[model samples]
Structure formats: C-alpha cells, structure tokens
Target: MEGSNEELNPNAMTAEQTAALFSKLRRRRVSVAEVEADIEAGAPTNDAGRLNLLTYTAWMLKEAGRGE
Candidate 1:
C-alpha cells in the first residue's frame, strides 16, 4: 500500500511537492475533541462511524499505555 502511495509521489516536494496534493483533506482534518463529542452525542448513526470512533479511542489508549 505504501509502495503504491509512493509510486505517485512527485520527484520534488516538501517531502513530496511544495504544495499539498490533497489540500482539502488536510484542511478538514478532525480534532480528537470533536470525535469524543460526537461519540458522546451518538452522532454517527452508522456502523462505520462507530467503528472508527472505537478504533481511534483504542489506539489512543494503547499509545498512552492505558490499554491492554
């Protein structure tokens, strides 16, 4: 997967081009607080969103050494 991502990378960049290829995605990046608030509010209304919230929380706990 990383190979495919790198294959399309330009030869010159600020790590891969002076400008961001996916600027819109970069701009809309969510904050941890927002996800927590959404989860608390049951905002997803879908399985995927719930899964992502759980996964993100799990990862966070794991990184903080609070998860088994």
Candidate 2:
C-alpha cells in the first residue's frame, strides 16, 4: 500500500523543497494568531477557505514540531 501511494505521486515535491518552503516561513515567523485573525476577518468562504485554514494550521503545527 505504501508503495502504491508513492507510485501514485511520483512527481511530488522533494523533501528539500518542502524543507526550504517551511524554513522560509519560519524565518518570517508567521504566527498562528495571524492566521486565525485572517479567518475571522473573512479571508474566504468556500472549500478553498477550509483548505486554507487547514493548511495554515498544519504549517503552524509542523513548525512547532507538533505535526508529523
């Protein structure tokens, strides 16, 4: 199953690219509080909104070492 999953996305971003993007965000020190503020201020209002919220939370937690 794991092999199948990997095969399904053979062109995915490399670990280095992922690390660099996150590192850039960390250097910027973007706060989860700011993400929350944007959500509360009506950033979006559809599936995209939910996805943005999820992505923001995931990034914050990942930086904090609370994400896998």
Candidate 3:
C-alpha cells in the first residue's frame, strides 16, 4: 500500500499522507482538509506535525463515544 515515493510512516504521517492512507483503508475519499480540521479540533499529532494512526484513531473513537 505504498502509494508515494516516500514510504508512509503510519506512526508519523503528514495530513495528506494520513488522508490518503485512511481513504485507502476505508475505501472512501478522505480529504486532507478534513484531516487538518481534525488536528485543529484537537486530534493528536506528533511534535513533527505528523499524525500517528493509532493515536488519531483512538481519539476519533473516543470522540464518537462522546456522542457530541
């Protein structure tokens, strides 16, 4: 599932990479802006401005459980 020249690091992906990776996994179109919005909404990202798949997924699941 290596779509780009640079191997995607699931533990530390840029928003675009994250969106692309997730869109593939989910079989749906996930936009980079949406990922960026998630970061703005407090989805956790590493200090290097990269997202960890597990952490981000956990945050999303937690948010969903909140039912807000």
Q: Which candidate comes out best when scored by TM-score?
A: 3
- Shift of residue 19 alpha carbon in model 1, Å: 22
Candidate 2 segments exceeding 4 Å error: 1-26, 45-49, 53-68
TM-score per candidate: 0.27, 0.32, 0.89
How does each model score on lDDT?
A: 0.38, 0.42, 0.90
Question: Candidate 1 has what TM-score?
Answer: 0.27
Task: List the lowest-lDDT window of 10 residues for candidate 3.
Answer: 1-10
* Candidate 1 lDDT by residue in tens digits, 1-68: 13335433222222122123323345754454544454564433244333232444454466558442
Please tell me which model should have the higher lDDT, number 1 or number 2: 2
Please identify which of the two predictions, 1 or 2, would achieve the higher TM-score against the true structure: 2
RMSD of each: 14.4, 11.8, 1.6
Q: What is the lDDT of residue 43 in candidate 2?
A: 38
* Alpha-carbon runs more than 4 Å astray in model 3: 1-3
Model 1 residue runs over 4 Å out of place are: 1-26, 44-68
User: In model 2, what is the error at residue 33, expressed in angstroms?
Assistant: 0.4
Model 3 gets an lDDT of 0.90
lDDT score of model 2?
A: 0.42
Error of 2 at 32 (Å): 0.5
